[model samples]
Target: MFRSFPAMAFRTRCPVLDPAAFCFRPSTDLRNPETVISEPQAKVTLFEAAELLRNDEVVAIPTETVYGLAANAFSPAAITKIYATKNRPQDNPLIVHVSSLAMLEEILPDHRIPPIYLPVINRFWPGPLTIILPKSDRIPAIACNQPTVAVRFPSHPIARALITQCGFPLAAPSANSSGKPSPTIASHVISDLDTKIPLVLDGGQCYFGIESTVLDALRSPPAILRPGGVTFEALKEVLGMEELQVYKKHFVDVQLEMTPTTPGMKYRHYSPEAQVVLFEKPIPLGNGLVPTIDNTNCKGFELSTMVAMTILETDIESLRSSIAHEVEQLLSAGNRKFGILRTSSSSLQDITKNRGSTFKSSTEFTVVEKFLGSALHPEQVAHELFKCLREMDAQGMDVILVEGISEDREGLAVMNRLRKAASRIVTM
Candidate 1:
């Protein structure tokens, strides 16, 4: 059984208050970076939402990234509700959200921000970047028992306003059921968490449409635990961060996976009900021969490697052919619906438009296609990836074929999600 809740619009009027009285110390810093329009109905809704949060209840709030399931960072009970509501594992830690540097200082040991993070905070704070720092005693074990806690200062006006209104930092993770694609819009939150959570502040679609980059500057090389809205290239350009490293697919840390210090590290996340088949960029061999993958003996959920010392005239065309083969095989086994997530302008659309006519005439067949922007602009792809996945799932696709993009800028984060969501990776 599913439950429902009121998804409130986040257009509340900013009440005039004294600088000292406001939780955010600097009164001048409280204004939204974007335009601020006030509405009376939204004011009442914001107050109600804050009241619920003050009482240790979970509230879904929008951020520049994805919507977050927020609860009082200091309350273990409230934090537990977030875990129960999302069915998130206790081992997976949460990120603490703050409205101001003052609020952040309150949770830090000795009320001091680490020197190493000063440059990063200046460059990326109040945006989609999470930094892992030493946890203070005020932080509850459930939030993150580890010595370090992940914290972010969100630029979203509603999220900042809500935290300031409540007078405490919030421990929040992506506002969706665990292992599912993170919600980019309020409707996505209501669809997944609904009755599980009380209120969702609908601030419209998320600007980043992905989670914040989780950076552990405490590490020797200062590794990025998760690639997100913040790109490695951008981070590398930051002063004193030239040596930063990102944990890629090939680098496996078994201990870290089992006991993740933060979210997105230990779980199989961003997945949908339908099987996701990721088609990676083809690796060309100098020898001129077509490589063939034998799928006759492959069974359920088994990933087989296709390798050959063969050169392909057009790797992209071969990749499209390989995906078509997968679709045909599935259709022959009674799978009637398919979805294609395209990353560039290509002839892949021809498969969806023309192939159905050539399939068995008596069998019902359908194909849905969505463009995840273009590879040249990966941020656009990141923005549309999860939404398209959910839309395809809602339309009841049997399998989703996603064209993989290069690991550049936001493309790293885009491919990271697709790799986790994918059940099979077909490398040409």
Candidate 2:
């Protein structure tokens, strides 16, 4: 029988205020890898940290997806706390983050990892790719509200450390409230989730701000499960495999109204308390999330170009020219409080000028490329978009429109962000 998630805090079994649950320590070096606490004496030694997690206690573990409120995958009760704290939908699955291929065997039932996927995993694991395979009888169906579970081996050191110390695989999801921006820093987890969860291990910010790229390799056709750190193009580029696009149903579960599958699918996930809309065609409107109704009652919303576009791929110079043109349209529409931020590609160039390097190491170029660039693959671009948006949002901007990326490979995942991040959509 599936267990009911606790509605209240797990204070009795696990006290949040207990001194034994937390320890403080001082480290002047801000970049130290093992540093978990900010204040002196707040750092618990590894022994204490292991005991804290082993006791079915909640600990905020950092991952590339966001900080996950980790619980032993084998402990249903402990896992329940994660659901309770996040207020996540029970039907949505929880991803299992393992430390290594060896740890994966503990959860998997000797099923051979797929041959095609082997190279994909080799190229992507310890990073952001989540693969869904046949579930063992051992898997709890509640993980993603699906029979097949999502699993990944995170590349984050602190995330792996907590799991190794506890000696159990962890079922984790993005630590913020479900459908919110994933927590990239320990402070982010603390800000959004600290009160509800137990201890948060303060590692530095995540290199990649979005969730992992998820693919369902168990199926014959092989579905791109969910787009994140992994891009579909990267997968194809690395493996030289052919990808068949799967058209996802817009509304599978009515409880979500019209949200798609996956955790954030049921609701408007990743919105920063601001409304986002997507437009099939460009519209010069700045209103957040209100349904756009044409005279004939055709409904639509403006999306950040970042999410809704499958713009022609070009070089950095052409890309910049195109964006400057778009930005002019947005500015002409009376949308002010303006700023443009780029985490990855900033060009408007045609796709012909693709040079597979990460920011070719010049400050002036990184700045220029951030605003105007050429062809950008999803994996290359998805790395920094969210964090850039959040920072831009903080600068007191009202409406921000971003361009979308190609929908091949990890592009599927990039398109996911483009769809979700905008308060509206305008496909140009």
Candidate 3:
């Protein structure tokens, strides 16, 4: 018979089966050609999850940004299962999730929070922000893979409650197959990790469609290794981070490729099934193909030039034409259906209007458009980005064309994710 561990006693007592390690396994090894499923694992509850964590098993839990494959940070065997289950790179590392400052302190070497991160924690903690700090011996080496461990206090009630009940931190990474889009809903987690893990706590769709921003405060001047729900502007606005630097934007650090300080720094992440092509923000041109026309100038322009200028002055129109050209080329090459992740400034109507009459007549070409929020509200754009990409892939789009936004505020994270998702880029 497969027996479930009791939540009350499980928390206080180490696994009875293993003397060297604390972990739980059924008496019968089903996958060993020995035992069959006496009982199926049910949708996990907080109590069940706490018991499971006590027994050193991995579970799927929800954070505000995405679902996570969580395991007891102290258990090497449990952490190994997470890596094997996700097929995550061994060196990629994981973020340690804490429920409170006390739990966070329990895992730190000196039990002292880094002074540089205090202000950031005051503002962004219990939200979507991850900070890097020195790794402690309490954390298994596999969890960090480097000298420092990434930590965050998740805002999700279930996530925090689970950690608090387990009486320890959880080392969690996005709950999905490696290189796949992070799971925003429990079904996404089940789809990817079914039959591998014992339980998945069904949390609804994540508030932010992307992961948390990974910031390294251990370094001088500080740096953002990955952009997600938290914006770089928010970090900069923090008292101690007024002069903070973001990797790649402020300066390129080549060493990161060889030895990544954070999880996202050395991986190809959040890619969809179809190829993505990103178009940079369109440059506004004035009449006659000159810069925006001012009342002061037009003496050198000709009537025909002005007429041409009138046809394509708007940035949205220019972007539409550029994508339409690409669509035409793809149609000639035999791609049938295409997808557009539209920005507030551009839409399907704009692209259709720009498609040449000849290209519009082609029956083979079909275009699907999804408005991914707006450039003006990058926060909403960030929220919809991954979902849009996954949905487009499901729609069988031969290729996805995305409109780029400025790298400011949440746009910084939006563009970072876009660049990674896109296989090719066409700057407008």
| Candidate number achieving the greatest lDDT relative to the actual structure | 1
Candidate 2 global CA lDDT score: 0.56
Top-TM-score structure, candidate number? 1
Q: Candidate 3: what lDDT? A: 0.73
List, residue by residue over 198-284, the lDDT tens digit for candidate 1: 678788788889899999888877889999999999999897788999876435678877777888987799999999988886433
What ranking emerges by lDDT with the best candidate at the front? 1, 3, 2
Worst 10 residues of 3 by lDDT: 14-23
TM-scores of all candidate predictions against the true structure: 0.84, 0.66, 0.80
Candidate 3, 61-91: lDDT as tens digits: 8788988999988888778777877888787
Can you tell me which runs of candidate 3 are displaced by over 4 Å?
1-44, 282-318, 352-363
- Model 2 residue 63 distance off true place after TM-score fit, in angstroms: 2.0
Q: Which stretches of candidate 2 lie above 4 Å from their native place?
A: 1-46, 110-116, 237-240, 243-266, 277-381, 392-398, 406-411
Error of 3 at 180 (Å): 1.2
**Superior candidate under lDDT, 2 versus 3:** 3
| Per-candidate RMSD, Å | 8.3, 12.9, 11.4
Scored against the true structure, residue 182 in model 2 reaches a CA lDDT of: 71
